[model samples]
Every structure is written in structure tokens, then in C-alpha cells.
Target chain A: MRAPALIVENLRLKLCADRGDTTLLSDVSFEIQSGEIFGLVGESGSGKTLTALAIMRLLPPTIKATGKVIFDGVDLLALPEYQMRSLRGNRIGMVFQEPVAALNPTFTIGTQLICAVRAHHKLSGHKARERAIELLDMVGIPEPRSRLGFYPHQFSGGMCQRVMIAMALAGDARLLLADEPTTSLDVTTQDEIVRLLERLSKDHGISVLFISHDLGLVARLCHRIAVAYAGELVEVGHTDALLQTPLHPYTRGLVRCVPDLTQIGVLRGGIPGTPPMPGHWPGGCRFQQRCPLAGNGCDDAQVTSSLADRTVRCWKSAASVDTASIENTTSPTNGPKNLARNTTS
Target chain B: MAAASVSSIWSVVLHRLMAVIPTVLFGTILIFGLVQIIPGGAAEEAAGPEASAEAIAVLREEMGLNRPLHVQYLSWLGNAIRGDLGRSLTDRRNIAKAITERLPLTIELTVIALILSLLIGIPLGVLSAINRHNRIDAAVTSVSGLGLALPEFWLAMLAVNLFALKLGWFPATGVPSVELGWHEHIQSLVLPSLTLASGAAAAITRFTRSGMLEALSSSYIRTAWALGLSPAQIFFRFALKNALIPLVTVIGIITSSLFGGAVLVESVFVIPGLGTMLVTAVLQKDYPTVQSVALVLTVVFVMISLVVDIGCAVLDPRTRR
Candidate 1:
């Protein structure tokens, strides 16, 4: 088995406000194998980004996190901030959603990239700059040396994302936390960025925790996928297996939401209800309000139930297989249900 | 790349300099126009109230008050452009010479006050922002509020009483001669300059605190943190630099306004700076000197703003374009 690059166990986040503490994320646990791309898919406000921030120990002062984030057998959560600094960017690099905003506007790409290189490497400015240029070229930034002095505003969204990726890899980071790295780009650029990330992960043997709201896009890149609903992971399995026969109701709903160009005149209604606000989730299953398979047993939730090769949180996972008629009555609509249906045969 | 940026900087400076011309013109005209509307007759004030009507008329003619307003303005502007501000109507002393003698002292006081405010304000602001909503933030915020509210003259007097009289840590009045040595000169100016700085420092603290708070919350600062930069590096290299763009405007405003505040402080301390000279000129109805000093102060204010714009362009590359 490939060595585990990062493992998070029972991660919980709470916002300690004057009113009271609001539980933001509870019991978020996942593992990423070396060189594997693990997708954490969820809607906005579902705490996917929060998970990444928690891992990095970058949450705001008011928000508190308690959990073990073991990286390379060392518990990151237990480490002092000074030790964490040594590991962050050097071992665990991050790429934010907004590429333009992620970079300091006052500095040039060369300066920013060189700073990252020097942070952990203890290199001279010239050496750091050379390495920065090398990294830019590796990320497909043309004429890297010439573009070094260009500011973030001078670069396009796609180029900025590429620069951000290069900077993330500047310290030879073993694991990359990419928080919707391509969310701001167009479809064509998003595909290019996905391909680049996939290639980089394969070549460098770097593990990546890719967080995104789009299942289709995540499926194109991630090796394993975890579905988050209201700050809790409801399902985790191989990407194709999860997409084809999603065990959790929330995962199935997400799979069904992916756009299908083959199905004409079929209007896809997105997940019916908005995700519950933090501190307002139902006592049992957080997704119960929107789950089509929600039933009596769902009132009392169970921790993830391990099936043959998947972990699903839903109480109705076993009954869901026999309830084929219920799934059909909801109207398949526009979906890559074709892809899953094709896989079924 | 250096050559290109240098040329671009020059172009920006050129463009800014072009913009300043109109502002300077407007400022000069406004000063000249406003002095014209003052209630007292400069000739009568200069000749004395008992002077005969003929003598008053002769003085008015000599002073060019009988000339067309525009003609008078143009001649004054022409003389100003040539650095000849004309003699004071009251004492017949050369206004330009008087200003030349006093300008450096005023500039020194204002500069010291500005430097003091920046050194005090920026660090306190950063500290306040970093400890936002905590006791330190509250203390700094409330003290700055008091600084902003208290009148400058009252603060000056209080400072003089405490430091000069009670504590005997500083002199109460008059700047030291250069022969007294640089340290003594600086020391003697401390009370007046500190009093002048109090309000500006308070304003700057507020602006810098808010600017830094916003900058600290920015995604870039988060990126800096993620990049494993030390807290000091993240604060000074990233957050403070980002905050400085907006802070520059507030500083520019404070620097310009300090010249005005210096007028009162200089009078209280008897520093013999431009402010004191301006006060003397105004009290004696020395119109040429008053007009010249106003013009000089306005020009200084305009120049400070221009420098601020250029500084912003340097700090934020996007503004360079």
C-alpha cells in the first residue's frame, strides 16, 4: 500500500462568538495516500475550505479546531506554531480559489515566488529567483524569466492560477491543498488547470486534497472522492465507484446534479433545498430535509456505515438499493446519469 | 525591466506635475482673491487712522490697490514667480527675505512633528489592529479619541506646563540657536512639535488601524501565512505594505494640515517660524506678507499631495498605469 501522506481524524471546528459557540464542522475525517488526488466535494458553506484551513491551522482567532492532523506520522495539530510554519508551504502547500486575490498585489510574481522559495530553503536571492523561474516554466508560464516582474493584475485568471500553482510547488511541497483552484476560470482554462494538476501530482508523487463544489470537475481529477453535507462527510469511495453507485443519498444527489449534454429538454433542478446554516442543522442527519430517501431510521443518525468497499452515513443505504422505483419517480432529468447508467451495463 | 519601469515612473511623475499646474494656479488666485475681500483697508492700517485722506490715497496708489484687480493679481503672481513677494505694507520689510529666514524653521518643526506622528501612529496602529477588540486595542482607540477631541492650543499649553514647568524635561518657549547644537535645537522644539503632532498622530492612528485591519484580513495576508512567513514578516512585509497605500493619503493630509496647526503652536512657543511670521503679518495687516505666506503654505500642501500620489503609484503598481 502507498504510504499515507496525510490523515485527519475526528476534526471539529467551532466558532466561539459572544452569543455562544457554533459548531462549524464536526467529525471531519479523511486520508490521502501518497501521489493521490483526494476530492472533498461540497456546496458553499458546507465547510470544505474550512477543513483545509483547519489542517493548516490558519483559522481566525475566534474559531477553534480540535482534531489530529497527522502528516507523515507527525501530528500537525500538536506541533507548536513555529514547527507548523516549517511544515506549512514546505510540506503542505495551498492554492486558494481566487488566484488574483491570493497573491500580494504589491509584489511581483518573481518576488512572491522567490520569497516562498527562500522561506524554507535558505537560498540566496539569485538562487531563489532562478528556482522561481524554473517553477514558472514547469507550470507552463511562457518565458518565465521575462514574466518574473509582472504583477498579479498583469496576468490573466488562468495564468495567475498557474503562477499560484508554481508558488505552491516552490518549496517542493509533498501535499497540496488546492481550494477550488480553478473555480474562477472559464471551462477551457479549468480543464487545462485540471490536466496540469493531474500531471504534476503523477510526476512529483505529491498528494493533493482538492476541494470543489463541482462533482463533474472533481471526478475528472480526483482518484478518491468524499461527499460533505452540512460539514460532515456522508460518503467516501473511489471516484468512479462513488459516481456510478453512490451509497449515500447526498452523494447520489450530487452525482445526479452533474450536467448531461446528451439529455435534451430535461430541465435539471439542482439540489432542492439550500444546505442548512451552521448551528441550525437537524439533530440527526443534516441532509434529511433534502434527502429523497430520508425515513424513520434517519431521525437517529449512525456514524459512517462501512459497506463492501464504501463508507456511507445514511441509515437507508441498505434499503436504497431495493428502492429503485423511488429514484425513478424523482425524474432523472439532465444528468451524466448516462455515464453512470452506461457504467451499470 | 528596470529601464522600462523607470521610464514609466518618469512618465507618471510628468503627468502628475502637469496636473499640479492648474491646482497651483487656482490656489494662488484663491489666496490673492480672498486677501482682497478682507474687511480692513491695508493702506489705512499701514498709514495709521489719523493719516490725511491724500496720504491714504497716495499709499493706496503706491500699494497698487487702485490698480485693476486682475492687474494687481498678475503683477503679484509675476513677482511671486520671480521669488519677489514685495515689502510688507506695515514695516516696509522685504516679505520674501522675511519668509526665506523663517521658512526653514517652520519646515523643520513640521517635519519633526510629521516624523514623530508617523513613528508613533503607525506602530500603535499596527499594535492596535493586531490586538483588535482586546484591551490594548481599546486603550489605543480611546486615547486616540481623546487626542482627536482635545484642542491643539489647549494641548500645547498643557504640554508646556507639564514638560516645561512641572517636569522641567523641556524648555517652555523659543527655539535654540544652531550654535546650541542640533540636540538642543531638537529638544527645545519637542514640546511644541509634540503638541502639533498629537492631533495628526491620532488621525493617522485611526486611519492606519483601520487600513491595517482590512489588510490583515485580506486573502493575501492569509496567503502569506500559508507560505510559512513569520508573523513579523507577514505583518511588516505583507500587511503593513498593503496598508500603506491608503495610509499615504491620510499622511499627506496630516502633513499639509500640520503647517496650519503650526501657526498656533509657533505663536504659543514664540518659535519665530513662518507661522509666527504669518501671525505677526496678519495682526499688523501686512497684506503682501500674509498673501505670500498663504501662497507658500498652499504650494507646500499641493506638493505634499503630489508626493503622496507618486508614493501610491510606487506602492501599488496598478496605479502606475
Candidate 2:
């Protein structure tokens, strides 16, 4: 079997402030296989985005990061600044959330795209221009050559996003990191972008580490999902298994919060409280305060367990309860009895 | 496309002219009113105190001060429209002729001062922004602050005392007249130009430093760096271009101030420029000469501001709308 494309091992990050140091990420680890889409789902400030920044070494100067981000057998965190810069647009690419603001407003779309292409490779001006037109065409831009001189402000939001995707693909990168790429778009544009990204990933065989708070969308795109809460990974498993039965309470609450269009009168309930602050995370399970299944042992300083292929950091998942009955309570209200029947089946 | 470009240029010029009309009118009215109100009219000075009242009356009639205020203004305005600026009371020569002879020297000095300011200020600003909060930034800030505080006349005196008298490298006074060779003429201007440029350099350096610091923190600069562009590319293509909008506005203001500062520097260096002419007119109360020169400076300032505005619109597309 081929080695995993990317491996993040025991990554930890601390932000140094005037008051004191606050831990942002704690011992997070995951792996992405070739051509696989790995989803990291968390609420805002749960260290999901920080993990991406750490992998890219794009964190602010004051933060202290310690970990091993090994990609194709090379440790990214250990490379010098110059070598890391060389590898940034060549080996790895990133897509930010705000498509409109991500591009330089002063430059033409062609110039912006050509800059990215020439940044990693040397080519004559004519060849680079031809390549830029080809990339824009590939991203479904109409009249690529005619539109070459148009500035970013002239393009609509959806078209700007297409231009951004073309820029990200300029250097033929192997690993793509997309941080909430569709979060700022409208629903129609969001669907269109998702379809485009899916096609690109399939056609190019690019491994993607997709970060988002929209678990429903991630469920459709990602092969494997890691649920993070309060800077710690609370659970990790196959997408289908985790969606069908989330062992961690935080994951279950998140799945329950997805709006159901079929049930119009009933409002979906969200997680009761916000994610814990950085330095003030509760002992034992960080979700104990919000977890509906909290018990005496939930407050124990150390808790860990495994259920088949899923790893969960909850004391309750290991309890002696009727799994079938509990699984039914967590299912979406639309298909109430299906959960009951799946456990027995 | 040609039509579009022509229309756009036309619209830009129209808009700039409209914006400056009020300023031009206000400046002209204030200068004319101030010169008229000053005691000891040009006629009184021309006809000495020893002259009889009848002789003074004859001098006033010839000078056109015997007419009503409105008539006097219209006559002067008509002469200005025809490119005739009347005659100077002291020298009995054409005011326009006197201005043409002196204006070039002042303009040359101002241009040299502007070049010096840009050359020294922009680099110091870039360095200060790059090394923010370091020893170099602190030193530059403090030295520029001191330069601003020192009076221009005092600074000129000190420069002459040090470079011209003590070192014997340059002449202490007496500007090289037009009879001198071009090279000697320029050399004579060096000390005076430096004296005026030092103050402008100080102001520009402070402005550039602050503008660059703001641009460095902008998101676009960060985006440029993330795209794997080198530091030099990021500095020139992203940060510096954005920083120029603010710097350009400061340059316009500095250009206007140069007219006023040129007066003192011109006197100290003894160059026969408009500054010396204005000083002489004020002492002798030669109303026509002072009013004409003041009107010309106001017009020049309005034109410069219009040029700066159009330049900004071209450089930044967002401003065009």
C-alpha cells in the first residue's frame, strides 16, 4: 500500500500574549491518504483553523508551535524559511474563505494568475500568458483572453471564486488546504463551488484537508472526519460511521443542530453553551458541562475509549448502557424509528 | 476606445477645475483686500513725504488709486487678462517683466528641494517601517522632529557660517548673477536649496514612515507574501504602491508650502527671486506688484492641486468613481 500523503503527529501550539501563554492546540494528530478528502469539523475558535495555519507555518510571529508535519517524508516544520517558501505554492496550495478580498484589487485577473504560475517556474512571457488563459478556461471562465484585462472589482463574487480556484491550481500542487472556501458565498454559489472543487479533486487526484464548521456539507465531501472541541480532537472515524452514530457527545450535538427542511414547524436545537476558552478548559472531558450523558466518572482527570474503528475521548461511551436505545435518541427527528431498527438490524 | 479615453480625460479636467474655482476666488479676494488696506499707499511712498499735497495727488492719479475700488479692481483685472500686469511703482518697469526675470530662480530652487526631499525621505521611511520600533526608526524620528523645530532663517545662517565662511568652500552671500556660467550659478544655489530642503525632507520623512507602516500591516501585503512572492516584490508591488496615495497628497501640500518657505531662503542667499520682490513691495507698500505676484502664486497652487488630484485618480482606480 502507498504511504499516507500527509501525517500530522502530536501537534501543539501556544499563543504568547503579554498576560501569559495560552494553549491553542493540544496533541492533535491525523493522517490523509492519497486522493482522499479529510474533514476537520469544529465550532469557531476550536483550533481547527490554527491547525491548518500550523501545517503551513503561516502563524503569527509571536505564537510558539511544536510538532511534526511530515509530507512525502519531509518534515515541513523543520525546513528553513527559504525552503519552506519554495515549497509553499509548488507543493502545497491554500484557498481562503473570502474570494473577493483574497485577490489583489489593483491587478488584472490575467496578471494575478500569471504571477502565481511564474512564481514557481520560469517561462517566457508569452508562454506564461498562454498557461494563464488555459487555467482560466479550465476553471470555466468565459472568454478567458478577452477578460484578461479586467480587474478583480469587475468580477462578481462567484466569478472571483473561480479565479481564485484557478490561481490555487497554477503551480500543480499535490496537497490543497481549503479553509471554509464556501462559507461567505450564497447557497447557489456555494453549491456551484462545491461541485467545481469535487471535480477538480477527482480529476487531479489532489489530497485535500478541508476545514469547515458545516458538518452536513463535510459529510457529503470528506472520506474521514475528525471532530475537534476546545483545541482537542474528541473523536475520529469513517464519515459514514461517525454520521450514523457519533460516539462523542459534542459530535452528536453538532449533527443534531443541522437544519431539517422536511420538519418545518420544529426548530433544531443547537449546542447549549459555547466552546471552552483556551486556558480555562475543564478537566477530564472538556464537554462534560454540555454533555447530556455526563456522570460521576465523566469528571475523572483521564478518560479514553474505543468502539470498533472509532476512537472517542468520553467516559460515557464506555459505560454499560443499552446502545440501541441511546442511538435512537440521537437520530434525526425525520427518521425516528430507522435509528431503532438500525441498531437491531 | 479613443472616444472613451477622450471623454474620461475631459470629465477629469472639468471636475478638477470646478473644485478649484472657489479656492482661486477666495485667495484672490483676500490678497487684494489685504494689499488695499495696508497704510502708506504705493503713491505716498513714490512721492516722498517732502512732496507737496498737490504732487502727491498727481502721483495717486497716475497710479490709478484715484478711481473707486471696483473700477481699480476691474482695470487691474483687465490688464491681467491681457497679460499686462501694470507697472511697479518703485522701479517704473513692467511688473510682468520683473516677475519673468526672478521666477525661474525660485522655481529651480524649489525643484531641487523637492528632489532632495523625495530621495532622502522615501528610503528613510522604508527602512523605518521595515525595522519598526528599532533604534534606526527612533533616531530618524527624533532627528526629523528637530529639523522641523529649527527655524529656516536660523538654519540658513548656520549653514552659511559653517560651509561658506568657516570651511571657505562656498560663497557667503551675493547670488551668482545671470552673467555667471550655468555651473557656477547652480553651485551658488546649493547652500540655500539645502536650507529650504531640510525642512521639507523632515516633513516628508515622517509622512512616508507612517504611511509605509500602515501599508505593511495591510492584508494585501500578507497575501502577496503567502503567494510565495519575494520580500522585495512584496515591498515594491504591494506595500509601496499603496503607500504612495498618502505620500502624493503630502507632496501636493509640501509644494504649496515651498512657495512660502522660498521667501526666507531667497532673502538669506540673496537670490533675486519673487521672495525678495515681495519683501521689497511690502516695505515700500507697492500694492500693484504685491497683488500681481500674490495672484500668480495662488493660480499656480490651484493648478498644482488639480494635477495632484488627477494623478491620484489615475494611479488608483477606486478613486476614479
Q: Pick the candidate with the highest lDDT.
A: 1
Q: What are the models' TM-scores?
A: 0.95, 0.90
Q: Is model 1 an incorrect, acceptable, medium or high docking prediction?
A: high
lDDT of 2 by residue, B63-162 (tens): 7788998888777777886889988877888999899898888888888888888888888878787778889999999888987899889999999999
Q: What lDDT would candidate 2 get against the real structure?
A: 0.81
lDDT of 2 by residue, A132-185 (tens): 999889888999997777777878888888888888778867888888888999
Go through the candidates in order and give each one's DockQ. Answer: 0.80, 0.39
Show pairs that collide, candidate 1. none
Deviation of model 1 at B105, angstroms: 0.7
Give per-residue CA lDDT, model 1, range A148-172, as digits (tens).
Answer: 9898999999999999899888886
Candidate 2 wrong stretches, greater than 4 Å: A295-309, A318-345, B1-14, B17-22, B39-42, B66-68, B177-179
Chain B TM-score of candidate 2 stands at 0.93
Candidate 1 per-residue lDDT, tens place, B1-321, comes to: 656776787788999999999999999999998998999888888899799999999989988889999999999999899999998887788888999899999999999999999999999999999999999999999999998999999999998899999999998999988888988888999899899999999999999999999999999889888989888888888899989999998899889889999999999998999999989888888888899999999889989999998888888888885
TM-score of chain A of 1: 0.92
